[model samples]
Target: MGRGQLLGREDGAAVFSSRTIAVAPGDDRVELGFRFSGTEVVVPDDARVVTNGAVVFGSVDCGAACAGTGTGPEITVDTSGAFGSVDVRTVTEAAADRADGDDD
Candidate 1:
């Protein structure tokens, strides 16, 4: 299936306002795109990140405990009981690196 959208529900209803990034079938992985205010972020497969909301990348679930800045959109992924790596960067820095082909 293609990308799907999940909108937030109303009061006293099933509210699912959290955005998610998922990988499509036939591919080993997928990239999740997120836009908040004026910033855009990408959460890759097998990895996770936290922002102002919650994101479920795979078997892992991530989110914030309170409503605050830079702590909402959280992401989680199954590490398969192993330690993984996480790279955090500002939107501007991320974009600059992409433009310079200096992903390291």
Candidate 2:
């Protein structure tokens, strides 16, 4: 189909979302990218990854090192339903500069 249909968003320690995405019917892929770090990922329950290349997942981690596409697309998130992204970016404040460096 066209670009993935992004639906809803809910926020918490991690963000929750719903997106209606799909590859062409009969076709098994969509040109998409996924990257996460020190975080969690929640794929839609109804989604499928056809023709698994080097993709793997488990109860807690996305296996493989740190690449999305390798010789070819490593993983393809096939969907006609919703999925979620884990927003693990924490907000922090910059440290205040000491008066030592101030000319005033």
Q: What overall lDDT goes with each candidate model? A: 0.31, 0.25
Error of 2 at 80 (Å): 19
What are the per-residue Cα lDDT tens digits for candidate 2 across 12-71?
A: 221232222323334324332232211222222233333222222311223221233223
Q: What's model 1's overall lDDT?
A: 0.31
Stretches off by above 4 angstroms in model 1 are: 1-41, 44-72, 81-91
The Cα error of candidate 1 at residue 6, in Å, is 17
lDDT of model 2, residue 66: 20
Tens-place lDDT per residue, model 1, 24-92, is 233222233332211122343232343232333322223221112343233322122112222334344
Best by lDDT: 1
The regions of model 2 sitting more than 4 angstroms off are: 1-18, 37-49, 54-104
TM-score of 1: 0.25
Q: After superposition, how far is residue 43 of candidate 1 from its true place, in Å?
A: 3.8
